[model samples]
Target: MSTIYKSEAGGREIQRLYREALDTWPVPAEHLRLPTREGETFVVASGPRNAPPVLLLHGSGANTTMWRDDIPSWSRKFRTYAVDLIGEPGLSAPSRPPLNSDALALWLDDVLDGLGITSAAIVATSLGGWVAVDYAVRRPERVTRLAVLCPGGLGRQTTGWIVKALLLRPFGRWGLRHSARAATGLESPESGPVLDSVVATFMHFNPRTERLPVFPDEALRGLTMPVLVIVGGRDAMFDSHETARRVRQCVPHATVNLLPEVGHAILGQTEPVAEFLRG
Candidate 1:
C-alpha cells in the first residue's frame, strides 16, 4: 500500500517527535509489537500484569501518546494497553484500510487475539470512539465496557467546521493554532504545545481526509455492554447535543455526559473515565 506521509524525511521527523512525546509518559511503559493481519501493531503496555485490562484507542492523527496524561491514573488500578491505530502517525503500519467496512473490527480482533486479551474495557476518543463502537457491535462479548470522549459516528459532522478548517490551511501557523484551539475549546498554556504538535503533524503528514461514518440507531442499540458517552457541548466536529440525545435514546443502558463548557478535547475527563472503568 502507498504511504500516508508526504516524504521519508517528514515521516522520520514525525516519528522522532512521537518518540519524544512517548518519553514524557508519566509512568513506566513497555513498548510491544504485535503481528496482525493488517500489519504489525504497536502497543504501549503499563500497570500490573494481573489487573483487568483496559484498551486505549486514540483519535485520528494521534497515537498511544494521546493517553500520556491519563495513563498514570489508569495504570494504578487497571492494566492499560495504549494502541497506535494502524495508518496513523506512529510506529504502526501504514496500511490504510477502508473506514466504512468491518476492516477496523477485524484489525482490532487481530490485535486483541495477538495480545491474548479475551475481553477488555475500551476507552477511546473521536475516531477511536468509532472503532470502539464498531467493535462492540461486531463482537459484543469481547468488550467489557465502552467509554468514549467526543466520539464521532453518532451524529452528522458539521459542514461549516470542515469549511473553516479548509480555509485555515492557507493562513499558516497562527491560523492553524486558532482553529485547533477553537475546535478543542482549549486556551493558551494548556493548548500551546498540543496545538504545535497537531499543526506540525498536519503539515508533515497526509492525514485521512474522509469524515467518520455515522452508525445507524439499530446498530447502536445492539450494544449490550455498559456504555459511557461523553460529548462536549461546544464540539465543532459534530452536534454533540444531538449525539448525546441519540445515544441515550437508542442505547437504553448508556450513561451520557454533555459538558457545556468543553469542546472536543478529553484532557480533563480522564478521572471520570477511570472511575467508570473501575466499576
Candidate 2:
C-alpha cells in the first residue's frame, strides 16, 4: 500500500502503490507484510489492490521504497511488489550476520508464498540483482520472468572500490555522505528518504562479501526463466561490454542491452524502466 509521506498540492505524482515509489519520483505502491518461513513477516509492496504480479527489489544500501520514482505507472499494468530486504532495513526482520545465500533466497521464496504469489516478473538492480540471480538459480519454479539491471556477481570483473565499500560497511556510509553526486544515477531530493534508508541499511545491515558466497558463472547459466540484462553504458563499476558478454555467456537465452547513458542504478522516470518491465 502506498504510504503517503508528504507532497505539495498539484504534484504530478500519481497515487500508485506506495507514496514513496511514485510521489517520490520513481514509483509508489502500497506496503504489505509477507511472512518468511521463520514466521517473521517481511515488508513488501504490490500494485493497486489488483494488478498483474511483479516483484521489485532495491539496489545496494537501498530498501524497497527506492523504486518510488519508477514503479507507480507500471502498477497500472502490473502488480509491483517492492521488498524491504530482511537484514537491510524497512519492514523486513533482520538476521544476525553470517547469513548464507541459500538461506536468503529460501526466505525470499517463503515471502512470495506468504504473499500468495505463485510467480512474478522480477525487476532488480545492483545488489538486489545479485539476490534475484541467486533466487532464480535456486528456485526457477517461483520466477516467471527476470530483468536484471547492472547486476553484480556476473563473474566478469569486480570493482575493488565496490567490494571494499560493500564489505566494510562504514566506509560505504562515509562515501555516501560525501559522494551523493556519485551515489545514484538519478538526482533528486525526491529520493531523499529512500537514500537515507539506503545509508542506514549500508551501515547496519550491510553484507560481508566473504560471509555470503558470491555467485559463480555456473549459477547464471542455470536460470531457465527468460532473462533480460541491462547495463548502463557509463557504469564505471563494471564495463558494459564485459557485462553483456558475461550475461550472454552465462544465460545463453538472455536478451541483453547496454544503455550508454544510464548508471549502475539504471532506473528512473517511467517510460524507459516500464519498457523493460513490459518486456
Candidate 3:
C-alpha cells in the first residue's frame, strides 16, 4: 500500500518526532499496537486497569500526542486510550477510507474491540469529533458519553476559511504558521512552538483533502448517550454558534458550551471535559 507521507524520509522524520512527543506524556503510558482490518492501529494507554474506559480521538493531521496536556488529568480518573486514527500522520495504517461511508465507524469498532472495551466515553476534537459522532450514531450502545470540541459535521464548513488556507499554502512555513494561528485562533508568539510542530507535520505529511460530511439531523438525534458539545465562538473552520444551536435543537438534553474567546483549537478544556466525563 502507498504511504500517506510525502516520502519515506519524511515519514521517518514524522515518526521520530512522534516518538519524541510520546516521551513527553505527562504520565507513564503503555504503547500498544493492535491488529485491525485496516492494519495495525497504535494506541497509548494510561490510567488504572479497573477504571471506566475513555477514548481520546484527535483532530486531522494530529496523533495521540495531541492529548499530551490533557491525558494526565484524564488518565487519573479513567483508563484512557489515545488512539492514532488510521491514515493520519501517526503510527497507524495509511489506508485512506471514504469519509462519507461507515469505514471510520468500523475502524473504531475494531480498535475498541482490540482493546477489550465494550463501551467507552469519547472525547474528540475537530475531525476526530466527526468520527466520534459517527460512531455514536452508528453504534450507540458502545458509547457511554460523548464530548466534542469544535467538531465538524454539525454545521457547514466556511468557504472563506478554505480559500484562505489554500492561499497560504504556497507561502511556505511563514504562511502556514499564519494559517495555523488563524485556524486555531491562537496568538502566534504564545502558540509558536505548537504552530511550528503543526507546520512541520504539514510540510512532511499528506493531509486528507476531503471535507467532512455533515451529519444529518436524524443521526444527531439518534445519539442516545449523554452528550457534551463545546465550540469556539470565533472558530474559523465552521459556524460554531450554528453547530451549538444544532446540537441543542437536536439533542435537547445535551450540554453545550460556547466559549466566545476561544477559536478552532480547544486548549485548556481538559478540566471541564474531565468533570463531564466524571459526571
Of candidates 3 and 2, the better by TM-score: 3
Would you list the C-alpha lDDT of every candidate in the order shown? Answer: 0.87, 0.63, 0.90
lDDT of 1 by residue, 59-99 (tens): 88888887887888999999999999999998999988998
True-structure RMSD for candidate 2 = 7.5
Which candidate do you rate higher for TM-score, 1 or 3? Answer: 3
Ranking by lDDT: 3, 1, 2
Task: State the displacement of the C-alpha of residue 71, model 3, in Å, after optimal TM-score superposition.
Answer: 1.2
Q: Which ten residues in a row have the lowest lDDT in candidate 2?
A: 1-10
Preferred candidate (lDDT higher): 2 or 3: 3
TM-score ranking, best first: 3, 1, 2
Model 2 agreement with the true structure over 33-141: per-residue lDDT tens digits: 7667544654546466566788887765456666665665777788777786654444455453243537777788788887787878888887778788888888898
lDDT of 3 by residue, 196-228 (tens): 778889788887878899998998999878999
Model 3 scores what on Cα lDDT? 0.90
Which residue pairs does candidate 3 place in steric collision?
none
Against the true structure, what is each candidate's TM-score?
0.96, 0.73, 0.96
Q: By TM-score, who's the top model here?
A: 3
The numbered model that scores best in lDDT is: 3
